[model samples]
Target: MTGTGQALWRRVPLWGVDASLVALSLLDAWINLYGEASPFMWASAALGCAGLFLRRRLPLAAFLLTLPMLVFMDVAVAPMVALYTVAAHTRNRLLLAGCALLNAAASTLVWPMSDTLSGEDRTWTLIQFVYTLATAFAPVLFGQLVQARQDVARQLVEVEEAREHESALYAQTVLARERAQLAREMHDVVSHQVSLIAVQAGALQVAAKDPQTRDGARAIRTLSVNTLDELRHMVTLLRASGGRATELTPQPTLAELQQLIANSGIETTLAGELPPGISTTAQRTIYRTVQEALTNVRKHAPGARAEVRLWHDTQHFGVTITNTAPTRPSVPLPSAHHGLIGLRERAELLDGTLTAEPTRQGGFTIELRAPTHPS
Candidate 1:
């Protein structure tokens, strides 16, 4: 439905209740009482009850309009309900107290004990007076309670919305960081391979004698130039913005670890199988951890024997890479390299732990332990 239709639907029940109250007041003053009903008094009560229809939107007007009925009828419902509407909307304590006092005074005067009060009449009149005060005050207090409850519920909804918003922002920031890390890894791997190609191309251009061989060398150089241009473009795209896809191969998992070690040509022992139901995300983390550890070992400890161990129990999966001190040490890579830091962050995202430390045996060890299943 349209906005106006929805609003009208909400108001229909309120108006129906108001109409019911008016009808009930008329019937009570006329047909349902033990005393003889006066036509004037019954009409006054019905008119006052009509004010309930406007109480939600025009509370003060409804209260003032219905006040006369309280002065003329000994027991009434409409004025108390009208006073409740005003109290629910207004925050002024003095105004609420004054309205309650006025209704109580008018209600007490409507009784007949003011004339010729015997001892029994006086006692009954005092009890009636206390009852009148309770009637006048209870509705306003109840209205205030309703207002407080609604306020607390609204605040809870706002807090939940705020928490969700903060969570989204944190996820976006983590995604951006991961993208930058991937771009850096691609740059390092591609540049290393491209440098070797450039060196081979130069040797061909210098040594080739036949026309066909020279032409092939020139083509190889051109292809390398084009490849470098594309690499630069890919890196730019990866960093300039986020939440975009790139046509990259799927990440390696445990299946590729053997090829990784064989290609490294390092004498390393590999043991342990991945447990069932390990998440794809955790698999990628394990792959990257091993990759970074192997790269570090190759760079810093060229010919040292290394050991790779994998283990898992019902609750956890782990990887450990250890290498003896370098038989031949070389200058290390730049400190700004992100491999170890990315692995640490990757493990943390999975609620896992990664540790790289030197053992007392004069060797470095990298250990990673993560849950076997996603939480």
Candidate 2:
């Protein structure tokens, strides 16, 4: 269809009609360049020019007027341009019907004057009369067909675009449902186990004799409890059904670092205003990291004061937990646990990094760098 439009517009025949009309108009003036009735020839030429100007706007008026104007001046010129405009722009069928009759009468009047007539001249003039009627309507017919084709093409394009948009929306809906389902399963499995670990560890801490043993158990208890709550909130969020309001649920933030440190029995200090709505994954990782660092502090350097610094820079939300080395030399550190491995895994999931090494001030520092979503 698009190819058809290009071909139709580019064809020489379609353009030739208008070009021939203009040429005939100019030829009329030249043939009567110097004549006995030069005044009437010039007047007819002026009318032809005026008809051309009004062809697109007042088409019916121009076409009707051209017939009388040409006949009165004794001119025999074709008005193919104005006739085509009349067919295309005007809606008055009677006017076109009257114009057709007047045109046939005018053509017959000039038919006797031309010397090109033979025995077939009457038949030729009749055929030409019918041809003139059809040719006058060619522009209107072609213009209508073009408009209809363009309308159909536009509709098809709109339908294709609408289908693509619907497919993309469906895919996003499927992905969101899958993510919510995974969040539910994670909550169900981890929450119960963490809660039990925290309760039992807290109970064990009460009966421990030495301060180091007590502090280690207490650290485990706090981490377990926080992990449990976080998991529970995640499950609640997934279990919700219908409407946007159901999506809300409890979660943790960096502000809870103090309570996390207290339960670890580490002398912790915090500085800077904490950001809000710290993601669940980020908070969970930070809590576990702090728990591990403080437990290591208590087990290896029992009397060493622990410092927990949590602050948000322009780019990263950081957690730096450092503790003094054991006053007595050669104290053995606690055995490595799954907590550090899990913390590393969690950080990697969020495209963050975690490092545990000795700080410049002679203490072990657990540094966590998290890419936070800005509030």
Candidate 3:
């Protein structure tokens, strides 16, 4: 049924209850053999029972209006039910107590005269009060108990909700700690090895007799230096406050940077297609190498011609980025020069290698090789 229809249906029982109260008023008087007093007793009974229709909307008013009528009316139960409604709905203890006292007082003053009163003429009305007053105020006591139980139930629900929220916050703290630990391990283990490679490569370039071998050593040294710079910056991010919060944003992919490189004014000569199922580690390493290479060219060799080559054979997939020396080396820019070092560490993690160095003609080159199927 619709809400309005359901509400009307619920009131149907209340209408019957109200009719019963009015009929009960007549029976209480007639059963007590209150002799033919005029229609005045009937009028009072009708008015007393009728007040119940407004008890929920105007409970205190309904009780006040009906209580006094019991002084003359034969209302057997309406005033007590109205008093219970007031007690349950009232939020203020002071107000509820006052209303309960008022109900007891009205009963003391009025019940002696009403046929709803079981108490008739007795020598000790005050002693009889101890017995009669209990019945009059019992509804208020029951309603207050009901209210107390409901309050406790609501408090339990609030406590449960608070505990769940605290548990979620604890879970987040543990996850951030794990990410920071991984960053620390990279710095302690892989960073040391890459640094050693850079130093050896620098030594080899100076000692080499052949032109091609010397050039390859120079390239490896350059790549190592850049990788160190990148690794340091990445570690800093992981250790910073709310570092994990930033990871939710997507990282760049090597396969998806056509526009990104083009917009940066690098004439990318991308060759073979990246293999279909390259791992996430490979993708990130390639993207970082290209990104760092372009950045280095922009800083040290402004307006340098650049080329990118991608190819993969049975055992390996590779990318090479080479750029001519800048036309204006005089243009000043700050360089931590560690991006390639970070990329090498990434490659090492995937059981791969990356090399970077300057060409004999004063151009820079970076090459990365990742396994087709990582162990």
Candidate 4:
């Protein structure tokens, strides 16, 4: 059947199908005994038709119940359906063969007290028994075929799912290879040039006679060095190629805060200290918040003097970075403000909050607040 048709067929209640089978069996019984009024025969036929309802739950018992009708009345529907139900549910070939033989015998033989076979009658009875046996086996074979078809369908679905999963894994491997190639290019070409620029800037800072030239060269060297550190981290991540987590380098934490401030090239003062034993993730969040704040100060609030303050109470722990007004005229630089957005996301991951706003004193302040021990 087509997929939609099969789905609709399945939606038909199982009990309804059983009821329909019982009705068909009863109709067969009525047609066979149209003129007869034997109470024993009628009662056996009724019992056999009712037994169809139990076919799903008790296939063997339902088949047994139909045998009396097959022996006493000339009816085929009830016994055939019961045999099919047994074949579909069970895998024992011996049991199915025995049931088929019993069905054939019940239909072919007369009650011993009613009739006796002899001569030509005996020979015909033998042929009729063989014919009835073959007919009884028909439903059993069809039921087994249906059972095998369903098993094959289930296996096909499982194979398709496995194939899709393998394709996804192959795609991820290809992506990781491309990322590794890109990392190699950046390390060889970009890092080499940046190192040269930093070296040249350092020499210029040492040799220049003018104070402004010396300060400018020093700033360039500092920025280059910081850029190189970040590039190194990126290269390490790419080379790991989605391997084990331990293959990645250690992340920045509170211990590195002082070095970050010194390398920032901003006239930044550090104050206060957080209590010990904070989680590594929380420390990293705090570190990134301060890093983004300092970078913004250097870019947007040029020549601003900044202060980094760490604070912790019984309930919370965080860092606040506040800067004074720019000492010189600020330059208009293109920014997508993604750094602040990332900082805010990091704060949220720790169930915390980040606030960045322009102070009334013509400066900016970025503050991070998080629980001391987040659950």
Best by TM-score: 4
TM-score of every candidate: 0.50, 0.37, 0.46, 0.54
Between candidates 2 and 4, the one scoring higher on lDDT is 4
TM-score of 1: 0.50
Better of 2 and 3 by TM-score: 3
Residues 217-305, model 2: lDDT tens digits: 99999888778777776565453211123224444445576787768766677655536767666775676678667866765564578
Runs off by more than 4 Å, candidate 3: 1-58, 74-76, 110-123, 192-237, 240-375
Candidate 3 structure lDDT:
0.68
RMSD of each: 22.9, 26.6, 24.1, 22.6
Cα RMSD (Å) between model 2 and the true structure? 26.6
Candidate 4 weakest lDDT stretch, 10 residues = 239-248
lDDT, candidates in the order shown: 0.72, 0.62, 0.68, 0.84
**Model 3: residue 2 alpha-carbon error in angstroms:** 27
Winner by lDDT between candidate 2 and candidate 1: 1
In candidate 4, how many Å is residue 212 off? Answer: 4.3
lDDT of 4 by residue, 110-174 (tens): 76624636565777778888999999999999988987776567445534544553454355456
Candidate 4, residue 245: how far the Cα is off, in Å: 20
